[model samples]
Target: MKFSVFLDLIISGAFVLAAFLWYLASSDNAKTRREKGDDESITKAEIFKSWIIIILLCILGLGYFFSFIGSLSL
Candidate 1:
């Protein structure tokens, strides 16, 4: 509820959103590569990398959000 906590969530959400968009782009690239018989696995790897980072960022962001919210409760 505080300004800092809200800002933190916004930043975290930004990172998460970026990662998701990257994943989509990577998926499209992978599809294209597959169609062209290019490096299909590389695209898959990039998607996995982005997804993992997104998940980790979300976990950290949520942890921060909840901690701030918890502080407000007291």
Candidate 2:
């Protein structure tokens, strides 16, 4: 495989790993907050932020995939 393809795969894998870590950390935060009897609003905000990160990642990944496909057709 070409070097470019290999680089792309590495970057994509890094993004996936980052997202997974973000999710795990967020969940742990929420759990700790619940255990402390903190306000629900704080937990909700954390969850929302997590969702936003996931959505943004998905958008970026899709954009990269489509651009790669476009390049192939050129």
TM-score of each candidate?
0.63, 0.76
lDDT of 1 at 73: 75
What TM-score would you give candidate 1 relative to the actual structure? 0.63
Looking at model 2, residue 13 earns an lDDT score of 60
The Cα RMSD of model 2 versus the native structure comes to 2.2
What does the lDDT read for residue 65 in candidate 2?
A: 60
Model 2 Cα lDDT, one tens digit per residue, 6-73: 45555656676777788889899899999999999989988998979977776666666665565556
Clashing pairs in 2: none
- TM-score for candidate 2: 0.76
Best-fitting candidate, scored by lDDT: 2
Worst 10 residues of 1 by lDDT: 8-17
Clashes of each: 0, 0
Candidate 2 Cα lDDT to native = 0.75
Per-residue alpha-carbon lDDT of candidate 1 for residues 1-74, written as tens digits (9 for 90 to 100): 56875776666677667767766776787788789887767767876886787678677767766766666677
